[model samples]
Target: MSILNHRTVVLDPQFKDLEEFMLSIPALFTENKGVVIHKGRNELRRIEYKGVEYVVKAFHRPNIINRFVYGVFRPSKAKRSYHYANIYREIGVGTPTPVGYMNIRKGLLFDRSYYVTLTSTCPYRYEDLFTHDFPYAEEVLRAIGRTTAVLHEHGYAHKDYGRANILFQQLEDGSIKLEIVDLNRMAVGPIDMKAGCKNFERLPATPEMHRLMAEEYAKARGFDAQKCFELMQAYRSVQPGKIDGLY
Candidate 1:
C-alpha cells in the first residue's frame, strides 16, 4: 500500500513491483495508451506492462454528493472491486486476479479511480451458452448453477449477475470452471433461499435454461428443485426490463 500526493494506491503484495505502473494509469488513460474493451458508464482498457496483460477499469468520477460520500464515508467502487476480488480468491471462487486499485482525491472529495486485474483467459462468457450451441452447454450451465450456490452459501451475492459478467473456461478434463466479474456491486452477508434464487433474475436465458440451472442450484443447496425453479421464475418475471426476450 502506498499513498503519494493526492493518490492512494493499494496493490496485492505479489504485485508490489507494479506500484509505479499502477500509479501511472490515470495519466496514461488520458493519453489513450491502451485498447479500449468497454466504454460506457465506466471505461475498461486492456493494457500491457512488460509481458503481462491487465485490464484497467476507469470508474466514472462520482457526482457531487457521491464524491463526498466516497471520499469520507464509503469506499470507492474501485477499492470495493479490489477488496472483493481478494475475497473471491480466498474462498476458491473464480475471478480474474486483482492487481490493485488507485483513487485520486481532490481536496476532501474523491476524483477518478481505477481497478486493475489480470486479463482473463476464458474464451467464453455466460451469454454464449444460450446464444450459440457451445460444446458442453448443459454441463457448463450445471457448473454455473453449482458455483452460484457456492457463492450464496459463502454469503456473497453479485448484484449485477448478468450474462456478460459470468465467464467460463473448458478444462482439459472436460470440466467447466466458472468465473464472475463486475465485483463492485457484490453484496456479502447471509443469503436466504429466496434471495439466492432471485439472484438469477439478471441472467439472459430461456425458461428451460433457467429451470435447468435452478434445479442444479437446488440440488447443491439441498432445496426443493421445483420450489427453487418457481421462485427464480417469479423473480425473473417481475424484473423491470427484459433482455433477449427474457429476463
Candidate 2:
C-alpha cells in the first residue's frame, strides 16, 4: 500500500550521451587503485576511486522487456534510494549524502544498470552495527518513524519496507544515522491508511522487538497507538498465503 506522492523520474536513456561520462573515468578507477566497498547479487558494486566513493549498479538482462520495464515503469532503486535519503536529510534527518553518479555502463558499448552515488562512511545495513552501540538509536528510530509519516503524508508508497531497506550510518561521534535504501517501486496515490499501516504491520513483528519498535515509533512520530493497532489488525485480516524468493 505504498503511495507515490512524488514520482521519481529517472534520466532517460535518450539523454545519455555515454561519450561524455566515460571521459571522466580516466582520472578515477583507471589511474587510481580503487578498493571494493560492497558487492551484491544485484551486480551492484561500490568502489573507492581517488579517495572518493562511487556505486556502480549493474544488471544482466538481455530481455527487451526487462530493458523496457527498467527504463520506464520501475526505475532504478539505487537512484531512488538516494532520492529518499536526501528527502530525509533535508528535514533534519540523517541520510547518506549523495554526490552524483554515472549511469551504469561498460565503457562505451552497452548500458546495464544505474550507478548511484556512494557513501564512503555509512554502514551497509542496520544489522551491520549489531555489536556496536549506536548512540542515536532512538533518534534514528524517530527519524525512521518520521520518514514513514512523511512518505504517507506526501502520498508515496514503497515496494519494500523491510529491515533491509533500513540502513544505519555511524557518524564521527559514534551516533547512528538512519537511511532508507532500495527504491524503485514507489507509487503515487491518495493516502490509504490501510496500505501504510500494512507496511509497518508486515514488518518482522518480533514478539518483543517489534512491540518495542511500535511503541518507539508511536512515541517518536506522535502517532496514536490505537490507530496503528487498528491498522495492523485490519491488515492482518487479509493476509496472503506465502511469498517465496523475496530476497
Candidate 3:
C-alpha cells in the first residue's frame, strides 16, 4: 500500500474533536453520499457531525503531471481556502466560517484535499436577487455595491466575483448581510480605481442597475461616478462572455 500523508488545521475550538475526523476525508470523499452542494472541478457536500451541519469541499485529485507540479510549486486549494477565509474575516468581509482543512498526499505527490466550513442559512444569492423581483431590491443592490467597494478598499480582489458567489441573508432586523464564497481564487494587493471598477466584469446587472451600483461604489470610494462607470463598461465589454438572460 502507498504511504498516505495527512495534515489538518481546525479553527474552531468547539470542533476540536473534528480534527481526528480529518483522517477520514479521503474515505468520506470516496463514499459520495452527502448533500452535494457543488459538483464541478471540486465536489462540495453538506455533512452532519454530531448534529451540527458543515460543508466539506473535496478538490479533484490531480492528474499525473499535476501531482508533481502541485507537490513542488504550490499549496493545495484547501490551504488557500482556509487562509483566505481567515483573511476575509479579518477584513470585516463576510464568508462562511471555516471549520478546518485537510491535505492528503501519497508519498511525495499531492493527492487530494478538503476544505470544511460551517453551514449557513443564506438561501439568497445575488443571482436570485438580480433575476427576480425582491423587496428593497435597490437597497440590496447598493449594499452589494458598497460591499464590493469596501472589499477593494481593503485590497482584496475576488477573481470570481460572479453573482452566484455572492450570498445574501435577510436578518430579523430587516437588514441584509452579504457573504462571498468560492475564495480560492482571491488575491490581496493594492487595487487602483480602474482595476477596482473592472472587478465588476462578471456581475449580471442591467444598465440601470449598473448605474446604481457605479454611483454607490464611486461614492463609497470617492471616485468620479461617470469615470468609474465607463471603466466598468470598458472591462465588461471585453469579458469572455455574458450570462444570457441574467440582465
**How would you order the candidates by lDDT, starting with the best?**
1, 3, 2
**lDDT for predicted candidate 1 compared with the true structure:** 0.86
1-247 per-residue lDDT for model 2 (tens digits): 1222112224334424433443344344434434444445555456554555655444354366555565555545456555665665565544455543333433222234444455635555545435557566555654555567666666665556766667766567865566665654565565454555666654544333334444554565466756765655555456532222121
Which residues of candidate 2, in runs, are more than 4 Å off? 1-41, 68-94, 101-111, 128-139, 169-176, 211-223, 230-247
> Cα lDDT for residue 41, model 2?
50
| Count of backbone clashes, every candidate in sequence | 0, 9, 0
How would you encode candidate 1's per-residue C-alpha lDDT over 1-247 as one tens digit per residue?
A: 3233388889899999998898889888889998999999999999999999999999998899998898889999999999989888888889999999998988778888999999998889988876677868888788888989988899888888998999988899998888889999876677778878888898866777878898899998999989988888888888533222121
Query: After superposition, which runs of candidate 3 have C-alpha atoms over 4 Å from their true positions?
Result: 1-4, 7-10, 240-247
Instruction: Give Cα distance to truth, residue 134, candidate 1, Å.
Output: 0.9
Scored by TM-score, the top model is 1
The residue-level lDDT of candidate 1 at 86 comes to: 88
Q: Candidate 2: lDDT over CA atoms?
A: 0.51
lDDT of 3 by residue, 26-56 (tens): 6776787568888998888998767888889
TM-score of every model versus the real structure: 0.93, 0.62, 0.90
The 10-residue segment with the lowest total lDDT in model 3: 238-247
TM-score of 3: 0.90
